[model samples]
Target: MAGDASNRDLPPVDVAVIGSGIAGLFLALRCFRAGLSVAIITKKSLSTSSTNWAQGGIAGVLDVDNQAALEAHVQDTIASGGGLCDEQVVRSVVYEAASRIKDLVDQGVQFDLSAEGIYDLTREGGHSEHRILHSRDRTGAEIERALTEGAADEYESGLRIFEDWMVLDLVRRDLQRPEKGVAGLWCLAPDGKVYTLASRCVVLASGGAGMLHLATTNPPVSTGDGVAMAHRVGADISDMEFIQFHPTALAIDSQHPFLITEAMRGHGAILLTRSEYKEWKHTDGFPSDFSYMNRYSTKGSLDTRDVVARATDTELKKSGDSHVLLVTEHLDVQEIREEFPTIANKLAEYGIDLG
Candidate 1:
């Protein structure tokens, strides 16, 4: 990073990437390896993005030889999209999953493996088969670590990383047609002075505007700065209406929303009502309970995230409760503790048992 605006001599670059999340860092790495002069501008340190807080895994069917699995993955995605998905795009991503997973692995992201020396895949909310590659529950953290280290190693090789800088707006070469016309960015340094850094191309990976919501699992940095800059420069922004909410979040003591991974439900955790929870919570071990999710969807808690979140919200509204109950007491406590040690320990801080 350069000095404050007064002392800085900003240089031109082939590409400028905003944000330090997985998308920005990965793209920056690829461009740097291609011998392009790359500069990454982030408002915070690389370790402070929403990606670091992501506990779920990346979905990829690595076994490319399995035609059935590949086709199933595509169908599952399209189905999850509820007839709104572009079939071509869904199939393209599904078919390319193996290659992308290989790319992540090449970047040194090590997923969990079983004793049989195979990748330990887990199934989440919507998927029919187990395809999620994770490092325990903190898959995103591991991926971010790999890319951050990769970027850090090449920082002195003309890979400029300007941290603690907020981009005010994107500069455009042409106002009439803004497609690929982004010239550079006007950014604010920590000292509150604005500076312009020119670039032939700029990539805005500044993540979503989830912080706009009254309650969200997004980190403080997710204020949609990149999107706002693009929109201000006459870029077309789509899917602003689709903000996904997690089905289970801990709102203890009115603190910021903390996500409880939905993988627990896929592992056979149940969502119970308050009364039902009071009745069966002390059982120590029970195979089944009344299917509360069945009232909303036939797939029950294993339904898609949007479906489950909506169901949970509706239940909260109807019951006039602050939250719906998600219990793992019936599941294997040892397996739960091992699989989700981070979540387990965090909950234990509040004197809550994950099991």
Candidate 2:
């Protein structure tokens, strides 16, 4: 691991990670445990990545009767992927999902649990079973805290985190063709000093370009720097068309869209058109009416994210509205308040409580 090497000797690290999100940090931790020196470079603090903003939980099967669940998970993923998913890759990740979750727990992540002393799994779009493991509403934040704490102990020892450092480009042996392999990176420090760190391997897990869209749930740092750099270095990039957008982002006029986690729907919230909601409230003063998703799929509100997002867009176009409403009136108020305190409180700012 090497950082703050402006005056000191720079050492070559075994691995160089160019992001501090869950993927990058988790990979760094694994490499460190295997006795590999690691360097993590991020333009901002470790907690500033999109990982800290994730609200929905990780999807996986933790119960013993996981064979069918795993199969369903894989199938659901493939279906949602619109037949473009690589079956081998899908199966590999699906099978390893539980073990990865266990690794997270081993690293100090505490997922939500039921009163029966079992992991309280919840459902989301594209999930057949309640296999999502979350820590209340702040699942991402909790995991980020745990991973940051774990990485801190290894920092400057087995791992070095370079915060406020921007990666300019990958240092490749042959700029003409990146097939030669990446040696390291050219980085710009906060003090306007440029430096380079050599490494045996470099990983670009720098996340997505959600900020490219006008309304996105992504943080400002998700400006597709990794993709751009990789493309510049002649790396093969794929699936630029498959950007996943959540269906229920909190749309306040002209404000950055805050994600309304799909887990809320998994917990029983139903999506409704503005007029449908208004009419329903006028009729009964409550949101017990059926949802538009019921007309599209048997899963209703539990349909896949792609389906829901498209449906919302269609409804918006049809009705000429800005956004849709997610009705949680059918769910228990106390349970919602307890399970999604962050969302509940945030909605309260806009004069919306679960009750």
Q: TM-score of each candidate? A: 0.95, 0.94
Name the runs in model 2 displaced over 4 angstroms.
7-9, 282-289
Q: How would you encode candidate 1's per-residue C-alpha lDDT over 1-355 as one tens digit per residue? A: 5432445437888999999999899999999999999999999887779888888788988889999999999999999999999999999999998998899899999999998999998888889998888898788899899999999988967788889988889888987777747889888888788889889899999998888987788899999898888889888889888888887887685537778888877788888778667767566545345646888877787889999888878887888888777878767899999999989988998889888
lDDT of 2 at 188: 88
**Which regions of candidate 1 deviate over 4 angstroms?**
1-9, 175-180, 279-288
User: What is each predicted model's overall lDDT from 0 to 1?
Assistant: 0.85, 0.85
lDDT (Cα, 0-100) at 146 in candidate 1: 93
Q: At residue 16, what lDDT does model 1 achieve?
A: 90
Q: Flag clash pairs in model 2.
A: none
lDDT of 2: 0.85
